[model samples]
Target: MIRFVVKRLWNGALTLAALVTLTFFVMRLAPGGPFSKNRKLSPEVIANIEATYHLDEPLWMQFGRFVWGLLRLDLGPSTRFRDYSVGDIIASGLPYSLTIGFWAVIVATTVGIALGVAGALRRNGFTDYAAGTIGVIGIAIPIFVIGPVMQAVFALKLSWVPVGGWNDGWRSLILPVIVLSLPNIAYISRLTRTSMIETMRENYVRTARAKGIGEWRTIWRHTLKGTLLPVIAYLGPATAAIITGSILIETIFALPGIGRHFVDAALNRDYPLVMGITLLYGGLLILFNIATDLVRAWLDPRLRHDG
Candidate 1:
C-alpha cells in the first residue's frame, strides 16, 4: 500500500506538471496581451508595463520564472485585479466553492445510493420505475437550464429563497447546490443500480443467501461493499468537478467562487490568474483520483494484492 501510494503520488506530480506546462504555453500563444486595453497607450508605457511583469522576456525564460515561483507556492500577481495576487484571489473564493461542493456531494451520494438500492431490490416494480424516471429527468436537464428554472420557481415566483447572491445562510446555498448535484445524483444512481444488480447475482451473494442470512443483512454486509466500487471510482473525478464550482451555475446565481473568477480571467486575458486556477484544478483532480484508488484498494483486498 505504501509503495502504491508513493507511485501514484509521483504520477500525479508528473500529470500536474504536464497540465501546467500545456496551459501556460497555450495562454501565451492566444491572441491579446494581459495588458490589452480599449484605450491605446504610449509605446514607452506599454514597454514599461511588459517589462514590469516580465512579459518582455523570452517565452522560455518567462515559463522558467513561473515554474520557479510555483516551486515556492507563489502564483504571482493578477493582471486585471491590481490589488490582489493570484493566490489571494483563490484563497478568498475557495472556501465558498468547497462548502457548497462538500454539501452537494453528501446529499447526492446519500440520496443516490438509497434510490439505487431501492430500485435494484425491487427490480421491475413501481419504485424501480419511479427511480429510473427521476434519474432520466435529472440527467436530461443541463445545469444552465435547471439553475434559472429553479431560481425562478423557488426564489422569484415562490419567494422562498433569495433570487441570487451568496450572502444569505443556507437558503443561498440550496439552489446552486441542487443544480450542481442533480446530474451527479442521476449518474451515481444508475451506476449503483447496475452494479448492485450484477453483484446480487454473483456466486458469493448466492452463497450468502443459501446460508439463510436475512435479505437486508446479506445486502448490507456482502453486496454493498462490492457494489460501491464503480461508484467510488466515478466519485474521484466528480468530486473535483463539484469542488471547482460550475461556471454557469456560479454566474447565474451571482456566487463569488473560483468558477466566476476563472471565467473573468479568461475573458480579460489575465494569464496569471487563469493559469493559477487551472493548475489548482489539475492538482485537485490528480489528488482526488489518487485518494479514490487508495480507498478502492482498502475496500477490496484484491486490488491491493494486484497492485
Candidate 2:
C-alpha cells in the first residue's frame, strides 16, 4: 500500500510539471498578450507593462522564474487584477465554490445511493421506474437549460428562494447546489443501481442468502460494500470537478467563485492566474484519483495486490 501511494505521488508530480510547462508555453504563444485589449496604450507604456510582468523576458527565463516561485509556494501576481496575487484571487473566491460543491456532493451521494438501493431491491416496481425516469431526465437535459428553468419556477415564480447573488445566505445557495447536483445524482444512482443488481447475482451473495441470513442483513453485510465499489470509483473525478466549481452554474446563478475567475483569466490571458488555477485543479484531480485507488483497495483486498 505504501509503495502504491508513493508511486502514485511520483506520477502525480510529473503530471503537474508537464501541465505547467505546456500551459506556460501555450498561453504565451496565444495571439494576444494580457494587455492586448488596451488599444489606447502607447508603445512605451506597453513595453513597460510587459517588462514589469517579465513578458519581455525570453520564454525559458520566464518559465524558470515561475517554477522558482512555485517551489516557494508563491503563485505570483495577477496581470489583469491589479495588486492581487494569484493566491489572493483564489482565496477570495474559494469559499463560495467549496460550500456549493460540498453540499451538492453530499446531497447527491446520499439521495442517489438511497434511490439506487431502493430501486435495486424493488426492481420492476414504482420506485425503480421513478429512479429510472429521473436518471433519463437528468442525463438528457443540459444544466444550462435546467438552471434557468429552475430559477424561473423555484425562484421567480414560487419565490421560494432569491433569484441569485450570495447575500441571502444559505437560501442563495439552494438553486445552484440543486442544479449542480442534478446530473451527478442521475449518474450515481444509475451506476449504483447497476452495480447493485450485478452484485446481488454474484455467487457469494447467493451463498449468503442460502445460509438463511435475513434478507436485509444479507443485503447490508454481503451486498452493499460491493455495490459501492463502482460508485466510489466514479466519484473521484466527479468530486474533483464539482469541488473546483461549475463554470456554468456560477455564471447563471451569479455566484462569486474560482470558476468565474478561471474563465476571465483564460479569456484575458492572465498567465499567473490561469496557471495557478490549472495547477490547483490538476493537483486536486490527481489526489482524488489516488484516494479512489486506496479506497478500492480497502473495500476489496484483491486490489491491493494489483496495486
Candidate number of the best lDDT: 2
Model 1 ranges with Cα > 4 A deviation: none
Model 1 TM-score, all chains together: 0.95
Q: How many clashes (backbone N, Cα, C below 3 Å) per candidate?
A: 0, 0
Superposed by TM-score, candidate 1 places the C-alpha of residue 228 at a distance from the truth, in angstroms, of: 0.3
Worst 10 residues of 1 by lDDT: 30-39
Q: After superposition, how far is residue 265 of candidate 1 from its true place, in Å?
A: 2.2
- Ten residues in sequence with the least summed lDDT for candidate 2: 298-307
C-alpha RMSD for every candidate? 1.6, 1.5
Task: Give candidate 2's error at residue 77 in angstroms.
Answer: 1.3
Q: Whole-model Cα lDDT per candidate?
A: 0.90, 0.92
TM-score, one value per model: 0.95, 0.95
Show pairs that collide, candidate 1.
none
lDDT of 1 at 287: 94
lDDT tens digits by residue: candidate 1, 83-143: 8999999999998899889988988898888889899999988888988987998999888
